[model samples]
Target chain A: MDVKAEIIAILKDVTGLDDVGSDPAENLFADGVLDSMATVEVLVAMQDKFGIQVPVSEFDRNQWNTVNKMVDRVGELEEA
Target chain B: MHNITPYSSPTYFIYLLLLLSPIMIGLYNGKRFRVYETFATVIILITAFFGGNMSQGISLICYILFEMVLVLSYLRYRTKENSKNNFWVFFWSVILAIIPLVFVKIDPLLNNATISLFAFMGISYLTFKSVEMIMEIRDGAIKEVKPWEFIRFLLFFPTITSGPIDRFRRFQKDVLKVPSREEYVALLKTGTNRLMLGLLYKFIIGYIFGTLLLPKVSVLALSYQHQAPLGLSWWVLAYMYVYSMYLFFDFAGYSLFAVAISNFLGVKTPMNFNKPFKSHNIKDFWNRWHMTLSFWFRDFIYMRLMFFMMKKKLVKNRVTMANLGYLTLFLIMGFWHGETWFYIVYGLFHAGAMITNDAWLRFKKRHKKSIPSNKFTECFAIFLTFNVVCFSFLIFSGFLNTLWFS
Candidate 1:
């Protein structure tokens, strides 16, 4: 799977919501689907899957609130 | 020379308005008068610290110099190419940043003295900003730490004394540019509204509750304490509610002034309270009450610890990890408040509440079909949460210590 699909899958797994990928731009946090704990799980899953280190401080809620943004952030981190 | 505590008196507001006029005009015209703003900030700080509080002024300068060297050095180390990002270096930097606050907090115990050589108004809030910057730099969230911007963020006069605890990135964003005319106008409106509300909350309602009712309730509670079980009487209950209101109005009022002044200055400092009494759970209460501080704790302490534990597979159970996080977060928060027994107990109490709250939430999720959800239930939840928080405040009030001990 591509990075976006993989992230969606991770979000699906963490939130237990299958429709989390319906809108790639949907805010998981604002929608109450992804809370702080769930956000941590998603970050950990990314580390395991993408091999990118996302420091908790670098996790801006606004920037990472959507699946597409998470994908972009992961790509940026990988490049760096 | 007159000492002017931020937002302390009518005269202070008069002086502040006079100083802020030019900045407001600059913002209205889409210009940021950075030099003038910095000059204003210096004037405010001098008035706040250089009169009768001269010693505090000296201490604040030393603290700033110490933190500047530490943060700037850390920034240099982190920005170096091929930097190893040594964990010990980062750890020691945070420790050194917090040492002044630690000395101030513990000074009361060491010499039975109320003041410490390191103590200064807003030391705790300034320490929070410094420690946060170091942590962010380590995390690569903050890539550059300009010296002037760093000092401005640390000593941004309005919220410097007691904070709504603005983050470095957020504050830097505001400081780097001027708001549009429309934005500035809106800010002026909001600032005006908050200033008026602050007056009502702090001077009127807060005075009624704190200056007027709190003393009477305390007296009644104490007078009836000898006859009641566990020294708990109806008067004590009244004292709890009264003190809670006083605490909310006074602090929230102060926060309003800080935010209002910040708005006028085009900084947009975050609001500290949000009708906290309306919260339906302890977690919700935290989100609504003293929000910046709680969010800071959630971000800097709880989230980091949880990540560390999860990363290390420390406890294996997510539930256990979360509970431990709450325990540590609240304990640290408690100690941060002071070394007093009541403060510590207050921290433990909230930690316990959070743990129980999490379990209750889990149970509710499991039994979702069986449980009824409606307005009445929602109201009941709010009522329950309100009383629970007020009781916590009572413990925080240190009356229990007086009632039981001296």
Candidate 2:
């Protein structure tokens, strides 16, 4: 799977929502697909899947609220 | 000399309504009288602090100054490009923020010397807000801090004592805007409704359940427990239900008043309870009950711990990491209630429930086809969750210890 698809899968699995929708720009937190707990699961899944580590201390939901933003964060972490 | 706890009785609302009338009129006219609002806030604070609570009044003043310096200093450090270790700054700031609260909560357990001098009502709520702001600063969620605005947020008196703990950013947004007339109208209607409901819940219903019924059932329950083997009987169950009702009505009623007052002031403070007894599981129960506090825990304690565990590779299994997070989150919460065996066990009991709830949910997901899906099952889930919660409340009430040991 591509990075976007992989990210969506992680969110879907964590939220237990089959239709998380396909808008990468949509706010996952705002749209109610993910809450604080689901967000943790998504971060864990990202780490387990892509070896990308986003430290919780550094995690701000506003910066990483959208799927696109999360993908961007993951990419940045990977590069760092 | 009006000795009043905030919203504790009918008289407080009368005083509150009189004080807030000018602000409400100003808001209805699409203007926020900042000076008047601040004056009213000061009046309420004075009434809360100095109205026969002289020591706590002094403590509140000292605590505010202490936190003001600590937060402003931390904010200054945060803005520096080449600052001291960010971690230690964050660590010390949080510890200092909570030090007064620690003294307040732990003082009762010591019995030797009363550190009540360091104590004031609403210290815990203020500490939660202060620590949250520091963490937000660390994450750059709060990029800038104004000292006066920060003080206003901390001392926002509506939900001061027991909060549906408001966020700094959210509160700041509302504080900076004067809601439109239409919006104020809606807020007035809803606010009145909420306040009336709160009055009904806290005064009437809570009186009936907590004041009237609790003592009777508690007496009977203890008497029966003394005679019964294993100190358990139907009277114990009766105590559990009655105490649960009392707890819900009393606290939820206070939360409603807090939210209602905030709404009247045009802040749209978040709701604290939402049909919590109808929750289908333990996790759902937390989402619905004392929502602000639980969400605070989820964001600050539980999620952070889960991420830390995953990042450090402390546990290989993701589920175990989540479970451990629940335990830590709840144990800390339990400890926060006070230094007591019942409270600790209450926290552990909820942690166990949440873990089992998680496992059951995962299992149900896997066995969806075999599991029945109907109103009966749904009702059964609600019933089970309710009983489990009531049982936890029984532990929390400290009645069990009194019954068995005392």
Candidate 3:
């Protein structure tokens, strides 16, 4: 799978919601799809899978609140 | 050489406005008078600290110097090419950053007196900013730490004493640029509105509730303590609600003044309150109340600790991990408030509330179909949350300690 698809898969697995990635711009936090614990789990999974370190300080909720945003952030991190 | 506490009185506001007029004019014409702004800030600081508060002024200066060295050194280490980002260095930097605050917090316990050599107004809030910078630097999020910008961010006179705890990046963004005339006009409108609201909240409503009602209710609560179980009476309940309102209005009022003056200075300081009593749950209450401090705690302490634990697989169960996180966060918060039994109990009480709230949420989710959901339920949830929060404030107020111990 592509990076985007991989991230969406991770989100689904972490949140236990099959339709988590249905909307690319859905707010995972506001919609209650991802709580603090699930968000941490997703971050951990991403680090393990993609080898990108996202420090808690650098994690802006608004910037990473959606599947599309998460994929884009991951891409940016990969490039850096 | 007159002493003036920031946002303390009408006279202070008048003096502040007079000082800010030139800055406001500069911003209106799409310019930042950096030198004049610094001059005005120095004058304000001198008035705030140099007169009756001379000792605090000295302490603040020493503390700032200590933090600047620590932070700049850390930033240098972090920014070096191929730096290892040593954990011990970062760890020690944070510890050193918080040591003054620790001394101030613990001095009361050691001496049975509130005063401490390290104690100064806004020490806790200043420590928050310094520690935040260090953390972000370690994360490689902060690439540069200019000395002037660092000091200005820490000593931004309006919110220096008690912050809405503006982030370094956010504050830098506004401080580095002068807003357009239209933006400045909008900011001025909002600032004026906030100033008026602050007057109402602090002088009028807060005065009525806190100065007028609180003392009378306190006396009543104490007098009626013998007639009720565990010294809990209608009067005590009255005192709790009154005290809660007083706390909210007074602090929120002060926060408003801070934010308003920040806007006038062309910086968009984050707000601290958001109608907290309207919250439907304990977690929601935290998000709405003392928002900046809570967000700071959430970002720096709670989130970081939780992430570390989950990453290391330190705690196997997610629920247990969250509970532990809440416990640590609130306990530290309690201790941060002061070294008092009531403060500690207040922290533990909130932790328990949060854990129980989590359990109820999970159970409700499981039984979503059976659990009735409607307008009444929502209102009931808000009412229940309000009472729970008021009770927490009662614990925080230390009136119980006075009743039982004193």
Candidate 4:
């Protein structure tokens, strides 16, 4: 229902898992929500879902490394 | 139209280097030309279009048509939420792509299959890249793409010939941004090195090997008449394959140069080779060698053949039938290389070898409890596979494949 819940659902869908527990700091990749191409794929889905284009430069940056970080970044993109 | 012959005089070198001077000036003027990596190839296409003979013009048009498919796909993806039936669109695009190739290779007056295009169809590869994008879209793997990004992926001039066969999404990402300084330097250095190596391999090794081996082949055909030489016939045929191996490495080197430069310019063209020679078996070799091309065959033709066979109830036993599936796939692959009868046999030859190799692996698994594994056996199999590959190429282009069989 909240941003955190949405992020967890996204991660679960990506990883094809039943549950991703409620640690806002939980690692999506380590918890098997994603693999090596995780960051890019998640970032892409997020952009497509939200209809916002993250800056080309931000892709190489560390902002999309985690679910919380990515949500915050996407929120920023929307605001901007 | 501009001339497109690379086999012509050294004038193209002077022309290209001088032509690039203006683009460099445009870069200095802060133009937005840094948006794509295949920018360098635009110059070549321009040159060909301006001065290329009739055939070259035809090839150029085929190339543009391929670029158009990518353009259309990107636009449709942007506008539509869902396109479940994009498969047929891509299929027709492939058929359209080959029209130019057919017209160029066989004159329209003679060949009934001619599509009445002006020239040959060398741009089918670009069509493959575009078709892959459409497939990805149908699979719901990509949500959207930019127009320019799609153009860069399809028409990025550097890979216009003998491609490394890049994937759509990955290449789209690669071309979206400018290259960092370090990346640029690495790309420039590697690209130049490979370009030099390609020149040497093609001009020097290919020419020299052809000169040495071809005459001997002609002499044998002449002198021996009907008598088979000192049983040296097969060996000579094997030697005839030297040019093919040389040509592959040469073309591969050119592709590497093209892709590396594209990367340095902030475009991410996919790598085409992966130590193909070291593969222990035919299937493994296919996986490593010209991987993108093989994948193209798999996605467009092979998978369809397999599904078709299944649907037709043509395959009785699952395993044996599956081997037949692989057989048809590689044979189709061989034919795709060229349209000649030699290419047909070549494709069938590879299909047969790969099927036999797979059968042997299954056999080995069943007998694993009785026989211990040996490095020697594995190494021997690989060595033998290389010769088998070499021999297949001989049939693809040499006496037996062309004259004996046909």
Which has the greatest lDDT? Answer: 3
Q: Candidate 3: give the clashing pairs.
A: none
Deviation (Å) of B104 in candidate 2: 1.1
Summarize candidate 4's per-residue lDDT along B353-405 as a digit string, tens digits. Answer: 86787567657656767866799988987888777877776666555543354
**Pairs of residues at least 3 apart in sequence or in different chains that clash in candidate 2:** none
lDDT of 3 by residue, B316-352 (tens): 9989999999999999999999999999999999999
lDDT ranking of the models: 3, 1, 2, 4
Shift of residue B361 alpha carbon in model 1, Å? 1.3
lDDT of each: 0.90, 0.86, 0.91, 0.59
* Candidate with maximal TM-score: 3
User: By DockQ, who's the top model here?
Assistant: 3
Candidate 1's error at B132, in angstroms? 0.5
A27-74, model 3: which lDDT tens digit per residue? 887777876767788888999999999998889999999989998999
Stretches off by above 4 angstroms in model 3 are B112-116
The C-alpha TM-scores of every prediction are 0.95, 0.90, 0.96, 0.69
For the record, the alpha-carbon RMSD of candidate 4 to the native fold, in angstroms, is 9.0
- How good is model 2 by TM-score? 0.90
Clashes of 4: 12
For each candidate, report its DockQ versus the true two-chain complex. Answer: 0.66, 0.38, 0.74, 0.04
